[model samples]
Target: MSEINPSQITFARVRRRLTKAQLAKELGVTSRSIQNYETGSSAPDSETLAKMAKLLNFPQQFFCIEESMPVIGEHAASFRSLSKMSDAMKNCALSAGAIAFHINDWIEERFNLPQADLPDLSDLPPEEAAATLRRMWGLGSAPIPNMIQLLESKGIRVFSLAEEAREVDAFCTWHGSKPFVFLNTMKSAERSRFDAAHELGHLVRDVYSMRHGETRGIEMEREADAFAGAFLMPSESVVANKPPAFTIKYLLKLKHYWGVSLAALAYRFNALGQVTEWGYRNLCIEIAKAGYRTNEPEPMEREVSQLLNKVLDALQAQKVGRAEIARGLCISVDEINALTFKLTRLSVVPADSSIDLVSRRSPGLRLV
Candidate 1:
């Protein structure tokens, strides 16, 4: 029989946001014993192991699986607000990334997903890079109808951030050649779209290629925000359709056109010099007074992942449901659901639906 992998214990603990001391207390063991078990110097007894599985909400087989887990360190990911996130929050997010790696691999084995087509724009300024990428993708200053679909179409793996990691908006990281973006679906729809575009900025600008945590610096955050503004609301489009005045109502009317928040649209115009400094300050004051900062007016519906939706639908056609996937991966179904919450909506595939369950190339799932 295979021995339990010690690292899996560490992963489960981190995923549950529990410290070694906490877990040891829950399992009725000493902290040193937990440390020893995690370091492979000792193994948890059967009773202790069962308690661990129960406490951590992981399947017993998860501790025995020999598969290697993906590593995502603090230096590797480009987080939006790194200074505000605690180590526990960051570890919880990274743990989700690790689980996503396994789920992505499982999906890829059954379907030919789109390959990465993002460019490296580290040499250019944020706005110029956004323009260049738009031209490269042939998106010619048009409003992106669906940011999630656009990202998935370009081979970026999109996932939802669990509520435990909600303190930070979103983050992106590169696992080998595959780029993954995790969004906090709890945010407003417009904010979520901006978050997706902001992560794309980090990816294309080579923020993850930095030497260390420099990717989380304030300047880098500004660059990513600038990139997101320019990418989502192109200068040409915003200029041609500039509102009559800088009134909050006028700005609110145009925000839906670009699928961004009213404040974002106001800031964009101000950046372009369309609104004077005083005018911009007044706009900000009005936005805050109207509570637009906290609550978006006329919010749109949250965007779901097209790639994951299609993959899950196709997988279900072959009798592979959430429970089966969880069992195969030695993970609990709740963990899987948490990773894909609001991003994947499981639907029944009609008997007459034209889906090729045996073939890997199922129409829209082919490589680009």
Candidate 2:
């Protein structure tokens, strides 16, 4: 067997959301030993390796495999709440992203997934960029019925954050040629849609610059928010449908049509100069009074990944189960679940089950 990379041990433990001391306690070792192991100053013996593998729910072979490409970086991820998040939380999210990169690679090798079709809009303004992407995707000014499905069809891989990291809103990163967006699904669907579009902005506009060390700033975040507004509710469509005067009731009604949060709609109206600053401030105050700041009214259904569902279904047809995939990746099934968006359904075929069972259980992909 190949020698283990110390970094792999750290990644495995961190991916499990374990502190060094916590993992050390579980492994019947001192925290210093765990630290040494992770820092390459010492190596664990066979017995220690076995304990680690069992404790971390990863195969010992996982530690021996060569390190994966460095997919996560400080500049790689465009965080929605970078200032509010802690280092541990950030590392946890980035580790999840690295796992996603591996999972995507595994899936791509077996399936004919959609190639990314986004155009370069780095130089354009956010609204123009959003408009251009919609035009390229042939979306026009129509409201997207399902933002997750739309992103999947366009070859943007989307994943849900682990429930533990509820502080993060959403983030996106580019891994090689693919764009990956991770959403915090605990939020309202409307908020998640906006987040999806916001991350989409980062992936399309800031990805290349991020690699060049132009890290995401306040300006970039504002640009992304603008993109999300224009993408979700086009100015032309808003102008055509909006009421003469912006009211909380009118904004609430419009939120349903645009599938955006009421607050986002109000902000968009203000940005478009349809509502005066005073009106916008009053609308915000009213929206807060109605408790739409944290929880909005008339929440839309949460969007899920269509591409992952199809891929998993296809694998099920071939007698490949989630457990098998997890084993192949040397990770736990729960870890796989964390890396996918609401991947709860597993098509299991018993030893005596007929081949017809596969066909009966698998649903056809819903291509938009």
Candidate 3:
């Protein structure tokens, strides 16, 4: 350990949000001395370090001691927001970080790896394009069990985008050959699942296009939607079940069957000549009037993403105590309680247990 220099004292003082004059008033020293201290023209004595620590409420060692810090990077708060996130919330979006970090690492590792020659989808017919993807991925069946997990295990990054990206429900970006898909999490699981399928469509079909997120031509969106519908529900199954006109009841039945929005299946019905274009439009208007667009009429099914499940398993595998994890990850005390609360629902910790844990503060948290 070394003596406290003026810079260290001044840095800590500013971080504590104390001004030079204010610190001087508290320390009973002149403002000039504080300024000189910050400029490294002067230093605080050991006794003064104690006083500063008492004021700042940070470990005295925080001044010069170094420790390994976790990588807390930011992601787009939303597709619309320009500002990046702060270093905080790395723990909150643990699954996102874990998968994204691995995906990014894989790209860096394979930067020089030759991209496997993919089909030139630009010239292929839409059916051929879809078929090409089907062959490439070997998705030989009708109904995908859980779409999110399916894409993630294939090296695609899927995040449920925030509510603001409702209009723009999903997107795809490629780091080399790997696709990063963001599904709007704020949406229903049905929609999120479809969005994942749709983004996969974009990744498979539109990989050659230089423009990524900002490229919003009708052609691209249409192709992706087609891909989503066919990929999730498949073409022949839909065609096999065609009706003259799709009613609200019919659409509702399939919503549970395929986990897709009513409007999406309605369009499919119209496209397959199950209903006239006018009938399809009227059905949508009727559904909107009934508030089916805003809320599920029946109880919606819940699906915990595989990504979140993996994180839970990882924690349990490490045998980390809840409180230790909370503090180590810089999360709220309540977060640990809430996570452990499920398993420890009936298990109660005494009031003293809380005090015992809190008393053992992080080294950075101690003032002295």
Q: What digit string (tens of lDDT, one per residue) describes model 3 on residues 1-368? A: 46544444644454344678999999888999888777767777777766876786434664443322222223222122113422222223332333344333422332221223334465664556766666676877456767766665565544443222233444555544545565555557676677777766666666556233344456766777787777776567777766544788877877677678787788776765668778878998998999978775663454444543443343344443444334433333343332222122222222222223223322211100
RMSD of each: 3.2, 3.7, 11.4
Candidate number with the higher TM-score (1 or 2):
1
Task: List clashing residue pairs in candidate 2.
Answer: none
Question: How badly does each model clash, as a count of residue pairs?
Answer: 0, 0, 5
Task: Give the number of the best model, judged by TM-score.
Answer: 1
Q: Over the stretch 1-368, how does candidate 1's per-residue lDDT look in tens digits?
A: 26989999999999889999999899889999999999999999888898899999998889998875777977788887787888999999999988998888877767788989998898889999999999999999889989999999999999988777888789999777899999988899999999999999989996436424453568888999999999999998899988888998788778888999998999999888888999999999999999999999999878888888887877776756777777767888787787788888854433343433445553448522
Among these predicted structures, which one has the highest lDDT? 1
Candidate 2 wrong stretches, greater than 4 Å: 343-366
lDDT of each: 0.85, 0.82, 0.53
Rank the candidate models, highest TM-score first. Answer: 1, 2, 3
**Per-candidate TM vs. native?**
0.93, 0.90, 0.56
Comparing candidate 1 with candidate 2, which one achieves the higher lDDT?
A: 1
Which ranges in model 3 have alpha carbons more than 4 Å from their true place? 1-127, 162-168, 210-216, 320-368
